[model samples]
Target chain A: MSSVHFDQVYKRYENGHEAMRHVTFQVNRGEFVFITGHSGAGKSTLLKLIMLMERPTRGQIFVDGKNLKSIGSRAMPYFRRSIGVVFQDHQLIPDRTVFDNIALPLIISGYPDKDIGRRVRAALDKVGLLKKENYYPIALSGGEQQRVGIARAVINKPTLLLADEPTGNLDPELSNEIMELFMRFNRAGVTVLIASHDRSLVQALNYRTLQLEHGSLIEEEVVA
Target chain B: MKMASPLDEKAAPSPLPTERHKSFGRGVRNMDVVWRDKINAYLRAHRYELVRSLRTLLSAPFSSVITILVIAIAIFLPIALVIIVNNIQLLGGNWDGRPKMTVYLQLDASENAILTAKQTVLALPGVESVNYIPADQALEEFKRHSGFVDILYELDENPLPAVLVVVPDKIGLSNDGSKVLLRQIETLAIVDSVQYDLGWVHRLNSFMALANRFIVVVTLLFSVGAILVVGNTVRLGIENRRREIIVGKLVGATHSFVRRPFLYLGVWYGLGGGLVAWLMAELGLFALSGPMVELAALYQANFQLQGFGLINSALMLVCSGLLGWLGAWLTVAHHLDEIEPL
Candidate 1:
């Protein structure tokens, strides 16, 4: 069964400008999918719809087969808990230590105190950041900060991970490293959907790709 | 899939559920998570923000002290005024047990006739004590006490009229019985006029009323000013941490999650300011009490100065808390939405 399904989805801003039109797609369980297009092609809007950050103007979205339209605001947080989101800007809280940042999801979920410490360490270790746990995000390199962001995303071991250009700010080598990290998470059975515009990176990965142009999904391909 | 090991089995390990079930369970779990860690971390991360806001306020010692002093001064003015009015009202000197009316006889009345009039006045209701001063005795006493003996010897006839001093038995002499008794005394044939300071009593009552209204208006104005001060402080805090709030929201922090610490900060400010205000008011009253007592002694009266009582202190504390909360609420509600992760 699909983990996320967008069926004839549409999103319009309050100014009455339609950002997305009849966008239909499905991402199956454990799938690694990429959404790529030019700026303003509704890539971020698509991620936002999936995150339920913005409600669609029309049509329906199903996350893990539960209709997004029916989810109340009180229940939205719970929906968000199962999904890990990484932004292009790597929005790490600069004031917090890397460890605290990674432990946030666990803390929000109210894992036992001991379990939080254990899982946070494990998540940081997985991102090769176990040694830098005490460092604040401000003191970290861009790649390290991005890794910390990734660590924070996966600490709760979410079933679906959404990366909105997870490596947008990194060099090619670091981007590949970040992609590899996503792959590792996918291998551990987490479904992954990444939104990126890097053509070379898209060609390098043999996965399902959805192309968008002016709010419409123009094409799809399996590079492999 | 590999079969579970003994340890794994003991841990209750199972295959990954279908995506639908996992997401549903996760949604429920996320609700629990957001409140648990994110809210708390937001508070911990923003501790410095609150302290810095307070420190910023305190950095200008002159302004800080002046601000607090201004509030205290405003609060003290009406309170002190009320205290003075209260003492002035007491100056009529324990009228409860000493309700007395003086009746003067006509100039042509004889001393025997005046004494008979006094006995009749004393028989009236609420007439507890009575003393009759014959015209001759009145004149002699005036000469002795008024320090006008040389002037008195130059007078050909005794000028003083016969006087009847009547004290009432009622605790409050303003009762209807006293009024009736006064009217009755006025009707006596030998009595020329009955003298009492009813106008002073009415003036004291009106002054007390005016003092109460003044306290209400002054308290309201000062409270509004306090809220404005606290609101401005919270506004600066929100501006200083604008970027941090954006980052938090982008990383999935909810609105309440971002707003909680500022609320607590406001509470702390109110609590602290309330304590300081109470202390300042009390100290003011303490310093003024000695002078108030000395002034009362000059009039040969015993009047005690009343400080901000426990009830007033409690009220100030509650007012401080409300002001702080209101200030923070206004600031956060106005600015938090403008700060978006986008």
Candidate 2:
């Protein structure tokens, strides 16, 4: 079964500009897909649609084969629990420590105290920030902050991970390191989709890449 | 195939998938968290956030206390006024039983004519009893009772008018029946005039009515003022934590989850203020009781000050709780939206 599918989806802004036009794509279970396009190529718009953050102007989106259009506002939280989202800006709560930021998804998913602690520690350890558990986001470096964001997104062990410009602010070395982390997670049966404009980074990963231009899919290529 | 352990068969701890259903069974689910583990996890994870919010509130204890005191005073003032007015009404002395009317007879009327007039008035509606006094007998009784015996002897002739003391039935004294009887007695030929000072009774009734209306108006004004006071306090609290709130929302905290602590804080403020106000009112009454009793004794009255009753106390507490809740709701509804996760 496909983990995330967008069928003829379109997202038009209020100001008469179409951000995504007739976008159709599917990511298979446990597969890693890269979305590469220019700034206005509707990369973030696509990720937002999958997360149900923005509604499509037309057509349907199926996350784990369930149409998002039919889900009510009350049921949105349940849907959000099945998918994890990581933003380029690394939106970690400044007041909370690294451990707390990672434990957010588990907390929202209602994991038990013991399980949350065990899973949060494990997630932090996976991100190589176990020693900085007590450090707040403000104290962390940019790459470290992004890792914290990634840890929080995956803490609940969601079936799908959606990363929007996960390495946009990192150096090339850190970017490759982050990509390697995503590859490791993908190998462990978590489907991953990343939106980015870094051509070299996309080429280095050699994953299935879908290219968009001016809100429409222009090409699909497999670098390998 | 791997062997399934007995533990695995029974591992499904909950039959219901949703926490909302569990809430119905246990009656103790945190609205923010679904299961006990979730609550514990959230708390353990967000201990810093919780401590920071609490510490920020505690840092300005004096200002918060003053605000709470103002609210308490506002709430207590009207309630105290209500009790005072109620007690005053009770003390004005309900004269339902004693209805006396002094009837003056014509000076030239003969004793037999005066006696007949008294008998006629006594037979009228609501007339319970009557006593007749001849002009000569009246003068003699005035001389003995008024301490004017020497002056009475100096008079050339008896100057006292014959009078009839009329006492009406208890029901007649308080209702329209007594007024009707007064009209009938005035029409008697030998009677000069019939008088009952209804002015005092009328004044008391009007005063009580005015007091009730005043209490209602004052209470309404104070209730609105209480809401504004609490709203302003919550607004300040939100302002202080604006950054924290934005971060919480960005990190996937729902609006209600972010709002719960503020709501609790508001309730706490209200309860504390209400308790303080009740204490202040009770102390004020206790202090005034001594002087009020002494004054009542001077008037040979059995008046006693009534203290705050249970119903009034409960009402005060409820008002406090509502004010707190209302204030928090107003602040949350208005300000929480302004904070965006973006």
DockQ winner among the candidates? 1
* Candidate 1 docking quality: incorrect, acceptable, medium or high: acceptable
lDDT of 1 by residue, A1-224 (tens): 99999999998899977789999999999999999999889999999998878889999999889898887754555566668888777777676789877876554443455777898899888989889889989899989988888988887678899999888888999999999999999999999999999988987998899999889999999766
User: Tens digit of lDDT per residue, candidate 1, span B8-105?
Assistant: 21111111223334434767676465444444544443553466446655665665555555544544555556556655556545564243577888
Score chain A of each prediction against the true chain A by TM-score and list the results.
0.98, 0.98
**Ten contiguous residues with the weakest lDDT in model 2 chain B:** B7-16
Q: Cα lDDT of all candidates, in order?
A: 0.73, 0.77
Each model's TM-score, in the order given? 0.75, 0.75
Off by over 4 Å in 2: A106-115, B1-56, B93-177, B185-199, B239-255, B297-304, B337-342
Could you give candidate 2's per-residue lDDT for residues B1-342 as a string of tens digits?
122232222111121224334454654545333344444544553453456445655778998788789889888888799889878777665454244687888889887887778788878878789988777788876865554677778989888788898888764576688778888898888889877755566677788889899999998888778778878888888887776675555444545556756766677667767888899988998999999989876655567889779997988898798887778777777887777543
In order, the B-chain TM-scores come to: 0.60, 0.64
Pairs in steric clash, model 2? none
Question: Against the hidden true structure, what lDDT does model 2 obtain?
Answer: 0.77
lDDT for position B181 in model 2: 83
